[model samples]
Target: MDNLPDEILLTIFDYLPPRILWSIISKVCRRWKNVVSHRVITMWDYNKVLKTHKGVVAIFGIRHQTSRQSPRGLAINFHTLNIRELVLCDNFPLGEMFMKSVHSIKTLRHLDVFTLQNLHTGYLPPPEVNSIVLNNNIQPGYLLNLARRKELKALHMYGRSQYYAVNEMSTMIVIQAKHLTHLTLRCPEISDPRWLVFSQCINLLQLQLYACWSVTANGVAHVLQLPKLQVLHITGSRMVRITALMELIPTLSRSIVELNLSASSFSSQHIALLAATLPDLRKMEVWRCDLTAADVLQLASGLTKLEDLDTDVELNSVDLMYLSEHPALKELRCLYEGEIINDELQAQSHIHVRSALTAPFPLRACGEGPSAGVLLHAHAYKPIDGVTLTI
Candidate 1:
């Protein structure tokens, strides 16, 4: 072990958890210490280490005062390490000095921050950052600054507490629309006028909207103009009528591959409309929508390309038996209010069946916003069908 090269030792260290790497491996020798110091460590592990060893600023080449009240508590030298991603959780101190230190890191490409406050004062991300996730209390002008960056590709902003300056937000979207491929917004204030700005974003592939109640049929009509859109999710948007959706189905039929309308009211006609119009859909989620056993059968029969189905539609034993023998379906997730069923269907038909008291929709995690995991690892982002839940 002593004669091993640094490269071989680093490879071995990759398999060990951060706890062991920090507590045991780094203490072995000065050579191992050098390699470990430069290793890519997650912010979670880094925070845990800081909590375990309080007032130890020299560990990762960060020099700081131990005093909690000190204005300049933390100062990081970006030259000492290769930090590629930065995630600032709600627990982390978002003091001015700390933010300044974070801004100096030129290698950062992805940033995830939660519960940002007082954004009107001025907060700018690193120029090189290409993906960003901001949650709660964001200002429109601050978003405009981020949108102006040419490198930005994915932006996810969630919070209902934003200032309802529609014009500023619309301008920001128009500025960055062509560059962004993945976008998610959860603001109730954004209505038809603001949504119309998204029509200029001709390159969008994934778009998710939540709680935009003012967005009526007119707004959705403009959004459907995106020629490259493949994934569409419209949740909690009550103003969007089913008739409007039916009218616009043909516009998105060819490009759309994944659709989620969990909060919408659905009927047999709606299901039949989707099956008839969108033949390329592979994953469909309608958990909270009204659906029946016959509607499910219609979906299974017409949508031959569906591989994953998540719905709240109640099914009898006969319906389950028929679904088990579905040719294309590999996974089924449904809500069951009563006792959990045995894996008899799964065993018989080789389909993975998951049941829960509530819908296992992947809208949000416990304390985090939508797609928190995907936002953290946004450098290699790929659209997933549905996030699995452990029942």
Candidate 2:
């Protein structure tokens, strides 16, 4: 044992789980302690350790101990971990302890809090976390401290039906996140005025909305007004009126590159409107819409920049024929109910491709753009494997 070199000993110790090494092995000998105190700690969460290990260790009659008392009131090692991502619950004292310990972790990159009540005011942004998710339970005006973290870039939020509270948090998150580029929301019943919150996020490039049923055309129009936004997704939203989108088509023509309107429906005229207005649109998804064969042809011909298209409206032979010859169409997804249509449409064709679009579909449109790794839904029937075909 003592004859082995320090390198060999350290190499052997690396295979053991962190908990076993820290709690069981470290106390065995001074040489083991020296190697572990410096090498074994990098990325770990104390709360997770306590929750998972507290019961399991006791069953095995093993004693697990913490290094120091957390100022957040948890009797765990608060300062030892090199925690880069953190998620806090509704406990205020724990939040306080974290505020104290986070100062030393300069590499913190992601932070999510499920609920926060009466968050302190003396709080200053500790280290910049590029991705952040906040819940609706935050108190009013409590997010001003987040503005101090200049490096914040991506934010995901969940809000409830409360109009005023959601609006306040949305406004604050946008205003504080000056460099924010990507934003995702999961508020089904959020009010209309809250949709206008992104108007302040000038540098924002991508916006994703999930379960956003209450947002009207006015809100989408406001979002379109952003000068730099390139990707827009509105999923699980049925409240946006077709007429409202028709009126605003001219505004989104050039700025948006990717668009998804899953769980929303519109007519063939509206499809023409999108074709004429969205000259630069690269990928478009209109799942569960009332589009006809002519509407599909119009889009394939008019939108010269389209690379991928997904629709719930059934397409026949004429639609497939036009799409096969399209100069730029790279991928086409047809969502249908009863029988498969690929064999009937391409009986004489040489190209045959079979691929999956993911199971259960998306609760909303999948974020940003089409991914090749999703499974096709039960109602989607079977799809041809290839996204594009020649001849």
Q: Each prediction's Cα lDDT score?
A: 0.60, 0.56
Tens digits of per-residue lDDT, candidate 2, 31-138, equal 887775544332233344343321121111011223233545442433454544444433324455556665555655555443334344544446555766554444
Question: 71-149 in candidate 1: lDDT tens per residue?
Answer: 2433343323335444444434556676677677665566655433555435666777677666556665776676666
Question: All candidates: CA RMSD in angstroms?
Answer: 8.3, 12.6
My TM-score estimates for the predictions, one after another, are 0.73, 0.58
Off by over 4 Å in 2: 1-103, 112-125, 135-151, 158-164, 236-239, 316-322, 336-391
Residue-level error in angstroms, candidate 2, position 190: 3.6
TM-score, predicted candidate 2 vs. hidden true structure: 0.58
After aligning candidate 2 to the native by TM-score, how far in Å is the CA of 213 from where it should be? 2.7
